[model samples]
Target chain A: MIRVDHLTKKFGSFTAAGDISLALARGESLALWGSNGAGKTTIIRCVLGLLSFEGTISVGGRDIARDGKRARSLIGYVPQELAFYDDLRVWEAVTLFARLKGVARVDLDATLDHVGIPDQGGKRIRELSGGMKQRLALAIALLGDPPLLVLDEVTASLDVCGRAELVALLGRLSGQGRSLLFASHRADEVTSLAQRVLMLEKGRVNAEVPVNQFVAKLGAGSVLHLHMPAPSRALAMELLRGHGFAPTLNGVGILVPVPATQKAVPLRLLAEARLSVDDFELLSPRDASLGQENHA
Target chain B: MSATALETREAVEAHAPGMISNVLTLAWRELRDALRARSFLLYSLAFLALGLGVSYVSAASTGSLGLSGFGRTTAGLINIVLLVVPLMALSTGAGAIAGDRERGMLLFLLAQPVSRLEVVLGKYLGLAGALVACITLGLGACSLVLALQGGATEPRTMLWLAGLSILLALSMLSVGVLVSALARRASVAVGTGVFLWLALVFVSDLGIMAGTLAMRLPVKSLFLATLCNPLQAFKMWALHSIDASIDVLGPAGLYAMDTYHDALPWMFGASLIGWIVVPLLLAVVVFSKRSPV
Candidate 1:
């Protein structure tokens, strides 16, 4: 479990994290959703007891300021960038972390196996691929079987394969009921790993919603765009309205916002009316941003 | 029950390792890095070569009948150690704490449960230990060769030079760590290290000359002024310990000899100790207070 209260961090004149408060219970996963300079890393730094900040932070019921070692003992941090001694072999790296964290009887091989890097123990960190290095970081964080994991932009720099490997590992972590507080700019990562999403903008919490509810909200406002023969457009709109759908004419097609409660209403209406369409496009909110990304 | 008592009780119940153990862990890591670095190997080889050359030249060039008190062999070796050992130690220490901070390794290390003070101590121990090991070994080799040369060897002088070299290295190392802590960038730390080496080794006399020009100084004051620079004090101690000439010191040469009575060696030793401690403690203070960024 982790607790942060009135945590405001400032670097000179600029405020990084402003009067933020949040709590995460054991077996829960919380994702911080923010873009660049959104103070995600600053918040994590404050929680790790690395920064001088206003207010208080506690991990596993121990105050960070008064009991840093004990609190850090409960935490396993995976930073965004690669952090390792390049010459150290996987076995040595893991064992070093184990000792630093004051773990007892560290099972280096078993720990690496848990993170899916069983065979990498013999190789130096310099020889590892980016994904392997990332896995190795995960392995290091997982040393001592820490109850909480604080990951910062962990999946941002990975390739597709690496991302999947990390995602799979996170899924396993979630399954094991370990608390996770990760900051990410990716939607899929939040959906896959976080049960609850905390939307952050300019160091302030905008919304905190369950992932399923957030997904439902995304679907509720999505427009189902379709075009029929111009002659039957009126008839099609009439049929759509009959299903309690408000359709707006956009260019040659009609856009309808489908609510999650009305499951299969669009298809049912289309099947019933038998309206042949020239084009159909379901424009979701995410797709709009994704399209802008590609265009940019 | 009082609140403070409860707090103390709870604190004791939490079995985090003490400061010494934490420092040991950090020192162990720093020592490993020092031993593994390519610069360490290069520095060791350079020392050995310098030693071999000096002692070889000493053995060949000496008179058939042993001449003088300290012999030419030690005088040459001391010259090498005085200049070279500080350079080696400064290079190591200059990068010690500050270089790691620049390379972002400090972020990783600081995220652990250890305190910043412990980090500083560990780094100092490791670096100081490393310089001692390499410099001593090189001096030992040089002394062995000088002894094998079979005539007019000054064992006491050799011992003094070896200890002085280690002390001088430590003094430079403290300067390096201090520069590292003060400078934000690694390039800046290294540049400052070079500037310090130049100022201490070549231009030290300039500072004393400027002071002498400003006001008249007694012979003792003049000698003390030169000793203010650690390298100068070390040089004076080395040459004077051989009971040789102070002629190379310019203008105040005979005055330095006249004024340098019994307390010269102790004063030199004190200056070296002061150089090592002052910069190092200042570094610790700065490092402990500042953020890793």
Candidate 2:
């Protein structure tokens, strides 16, 4: 759905992205993974025709630099930061983008339902929670049903539940044969929605790995830190270890790494063992720094 | 092509809206946003108050509640209009792109299948619509006040003032958009706008005098300077149309009247129109270059 070759972007003396090239097939999902300032957003911007670079980018078939308007017509983009007219109601915002994209009014109703914000049609944008606003952005992006979905850290600002729900929605969209090219640092988001992960470091692509190998080789996922009493911590660690988990005892918690989808497995095991925990925090994979290691 | 493939291709082509439709959609949204803004309400009320207050105070000074004509009433209102209207236009137009760019809204808006030229034209048209409405409200209220005071009021002078105010507003708006396009930060854009308002309204003549003294500049150059400032051009046009005399504008006015004679008004009109068109065209060029698309 999208092809990029020799894409190098520079700002004066500094290069933001260097000679990056990648392509995604019609029904494929690809991710650009990196930390802050790793040039993921820069690559996405180049593909979206929002930057002048020394290379070529094409969406579907149109050259982005030569035919940007028509090239962009094939993409539904969701930016990382949410921006809207605060006074506009949900329906009005949808209608505005709909009209701009030549979307019929009948489909707007269906899009709202598709994004799970049908009841929020009348509420002003400022009245919505961050999650609902993100959903509204998604709905706006989904308009015209563009063949390609280009997202830049879309769930970064969303809470846990909101992030999961949006990931699931995107997963469904991918299943329906939509091409997704997203940039994300969060492993759960990357693992949940992307089929192939492109690891980016300081404007260079270090490696491109399939999702499963990405998981096995890097243990790239969120880590659950369960805080409990000192006595309970030791017992919890031992029990978790027996259940195929490598739980370690920290100062006041047992750290367990698990696949993003199975985050509840350790908690379920603890519950079955009648173990009570005081509290827990899940450290997102973005903080893990595993992707920063050079693969040679 | 297969039947289904042909149908899909046709659907894709139809999905891209024309430039006019995109511009209008964007313009309507800008207008709606302006209407709902607190500043718009405040600006309207300020205009109404300025209009009514000026008329009432002018009438009372004449030792009667009733005024004779639009001449004196509008003569009193012109200075305030010159002071307030440009500032209002500057404040509104300076935020057109900088504010959106800061909030990341500009990128999102440009991500759609629309061109940057269309965005600039749409925003300019929408803001022009808003400024026209405000100026009309103020001038209309001032005329109504004169009519209510029970006298033979001349409607033509008020029409001239309305036309002049709209032109002035548009001219200042064009400059503001140009500033917004050039400045990277919103605060910088706003500061530049206010600085422009001050230079045009208060400092243009004083600076001209200072320059003339320091460099011994000729009167012709000074006249050109006065005409260059849109605010000065607007004032000359307003005063000449209302009182039918350019002598009140002092030497520059007298010099222009003597030099240009019957063509002076058209010259002022042309200057105002030039101010309106030049900055806007420059802004379009700058914006198209500045933005990625």
Candidate 3:
């Protein structure tokens, strides 16, 4: 429900985001992947009408530049840096934002409940942990029940469990026909959570690919290491067949190059072959190239 | 009911607070915060006490100078209010917008549906309200002391002084808000506002005096130059209200020198009002165009 076209944001002489174009549809989850200072935040700020940019941003069919109030009304935003008045209580902060968004007083409690902060309504903001504060930020963003939500680095400082919880919440929200655009540097988190991924480098989209396809292409050439009971070179040779790799057996270990697609196939076949395998493990290729690509 | 009527009814029910209500709400919060701020309250009270003490001392010492005690006391009190009140107003107003920007609260406020004009006007009124309250307390004390010493404290004079005080407050408040919009930091805004106040009140008069002395110009010209300064207008207005005989700037005062002295006050008042309006309009324009950094 959001569309951005030729969006360029420049600060002084530097081009932060140049000629970026993208669209997000209802019930779709898209991740904006980029390194630090890659214009992800700049793009989101342009959509929120928090910055002046050379482009058109439309939210839910309304142009943000011409009709910002209506556009903002249809969009929810979770800023990268969580900022709120520390003196306000959790519920008070949420309620204040709700009121600002034109939500009725009666719906405030229900909104807080929906964000899983019902019991935290009376606690001060300073008393909350990082994860709880992040949840509070989400609650504030969701105050008006906007149709589209833009979260910048939604899982930045959270522990594994908290990140999982947020990802699950986003998935559920998408299931309810809400559109989401999440920006993050965490590959595994984005890969697991978003349906489509937009990888950015230096303020430009480097690759836009489906998550499964990205995983398959990025997951090529895994190493299959086998630990047998004895020097069983024959078992290793048969296991390496059809994967275009000859097995090298040394002592009790066997090494093979198995294509990522044949990972499960060889493992299942070996188990069914009744070979006395003490231990076996499949290791994917080291992602040093992915790191270099991100830096580039 | 038909579907159109039903939708209209729902739309009416879902409407938020109007413009006036929103401004009033924000203004109320600002006033509350000002009242709760210990430093502001203490500084205002201290200034008031100091002003009253000066008025008392001036009234008591006037008999030795062959002047009427009551008139001298009333004049002293008026002068203090006129001179010191604008400085207070300017200091408070200068930081309103800049301070909010520094604290990063302006973005949160601007993100709402309210227009930038509403925000500026609300803040202007709020800070002005607090300044007026402080001025009233100081004026009331001066009035009590004047009454205790059998001074002629006319209601009209007091009313004129109050009006002039408000005018000065509005003028300075507008300038301060403008400076706040222009400056990069709150500290810079406040510093520049104080510097502007001093320049108008003290430095301009000094410069006029020095030029008059060096050029051998008539004292009347020197007096007329004071009118160029806004603070001088406020001073002349207060002096005129207290006593018609005493000519602080003489007949050549800026107010008198203006060919339209009769119309100038109205013009000056309009100009002051414009001062409040123009910068605020510019601020709204700038703020709307500005990206939150």
Candidate 4:
């Protein structure tokens, strides 16, 4: 649904997005994962025709630079910061955007309902919580039912439940044959929702991994640091292996590699063993890899 | 067969609205917001009170007033309008696009099918609508006061003044929108717009006057020099309204020329058109090329 070819953005001597090329197919959910200043926002802006850049960006077979208005009409953009008229009610905001998108007034309520904010028509923007505001922005983006949706850090401010809700909404959107390009710094958020992941570093597409493989490589293996009260390291190791953990006896503690999916199984096994566990911590492998990458 | 055909017709009948209607709807929303704003209402009220006071004082002081007396009264009112109306237009225009950018609402507006030209025109028209209402109320109140007194209040004069005010406001608004498009901050746009207005209205005239005096120019040349400023066009137009008996096409045509005659029409029209077109052209160029934040 979208093609970005060697897109590069420069400000004086600084390069924001450098020679990045990627494509997203219809109904595919791709997440742009990166650290801060990774140029994700810059790339999104270029695609939106907001910023001038070198190279080409095409949306739904139309070149954004050549036919910006027509291309934009086929794409829905949800910016990181959910900005709207604070005084406008939910319905007013949605209807305004619908009108701007050239949607008939009759379709506005249906669009609002589609975004899961059905009964919030009269709620003022200021009165809504951060999650609701984000939903309102999503509803605005979805006003014309565009084929492609671009979301930037949409789950940044949401609580766990809200993030789950948004993930479910994204899943449904992708199920409906709509392409989604989401950019976020939250690894877990992307891991749970994205089908494919694009990792960026220093304005470059450093890696592209399938979501399941990425989770397996980065999340499948985790470190379990356990301190036993009785200093029964050998017994703890045996108990850990019984629970499917690759355990190593180190001094008075046990270090184990636990598969992420079996995280609860090990904990349950430890509780069943009745071992006096002084302390335990689940160390995510992705966090460790990211730290090493940063150090390198 | 009939039911199948009915379903096909129903599907075909589902239509979306056109883009122009959408732009107008958005523009109407902006107009409503401006009208409901306390600052707009307060500014209009202040202008009305000041206009009434000036007209009342001018009418009371003059006795056995001839065409010259009427000319003076109208000139005073025109001066007030030219000075105050541009200031109002500048403030309103300065915030037009920059404010939206700051609040990030510009993204929401632009996300639609509206082109940059449509956005600029819609905003200009919306602000112009509010400006017209305010100018009408203020100018109409002054004209009413003058009529209540023994002064001659011509309908044509009112129409001309209103028309001139709109042109002037549009010009100032164009300049303001240009600044807004260029500046990253609303305050900077407002400051730059105000500075440009002062330079165009007062500073440029002062410079021209100094140059004329330095060259030891004739009285006629000095009078003609005033025409270089748009405010002077307004002043000349006001002068013609005061005394219609004066021969506007004679050698001393500065005072004699009809306010709407000959080159004056083209002069105001060009100035107004230039203000609307030039800045907007530049704005489109800059906005299209610049990256969205």
- Predicted candidate 2 versus true structure: per-residue lDDT over B1-293, tens digit per residue: 33234234433342478889989988888877777778877977887798889976765565443334456777878887888899988878898888888777889888888878788888988988888888888888777766666644667777878889999999999999999988887888988999999988889879988998999877677778888889889888888887677788777777877888798888889999999999999999888777532
Best by TM-score: 2
- lDDT per residue for candidate 3 within B1-293, as digits (tens), equals 33233233322112334567667756765676666667568757876787678667866666344235655665666667656776776777778888877776676555554556667777777877787787777777776776665555565666676677777777777778778877778899999988988887778878987897799767556554665556776766566555542345544554354545455455446555665577667766766666544
TM values, all candidates: 0.84, 0.86, 0.78, 0.85
Candidate 1 clashing pairs, residues 3+ apart or interchain: none
Residue-level lDDT tens digits of model 2 in A177-199: 88999999997788888899999
Each predicted model: what fraction of the native A–B Cα contacts (within 8 Å) does it retain?
0.29, 0.47, 0.12, 0.40
Where in model 3 is the C-alpha error above 4 Å?
Answer: A90-92, A106-108, A122-124, A157-171, A214-296, B1-18, B55-74, B82-84, B144-152, B211-225, B244-246, B254-261
Candidate 2 lDDT at A46 equals 87
Report the number of the highest-lDDT candidate.
2
List the DockQ of the predictions in order. Answer: 0.35, 0.33, 0.15, 0.29
> Taking chain A by itself, what TM-score does each prediction score?
0.77, 0.82, 0.76, 0.85
> Weakest 10 consecutive residues, lDDT, candidate 1 chain A?
A287-296
User: Candidate 1: lDDT of A31?
Assistant: 90
In terms of lDDT, model 4 sits at 0.74
Candidate 4 lDDT, A1-296, residue by residue in tens? 77888899998989999999888887888888898899888888888877788988777666677667777888788877688678887778777777777776546567668877778888889999877788888888877678889988988888899888987887777678788998988878787668898889989998889987766666567876676865566676787776567776555466667775665665677778777778877676665445445555
lDDT score, candidate 3, position A124: 87
Report clashes for each candidate as comma-separated counts. 0, 0, 1, 5
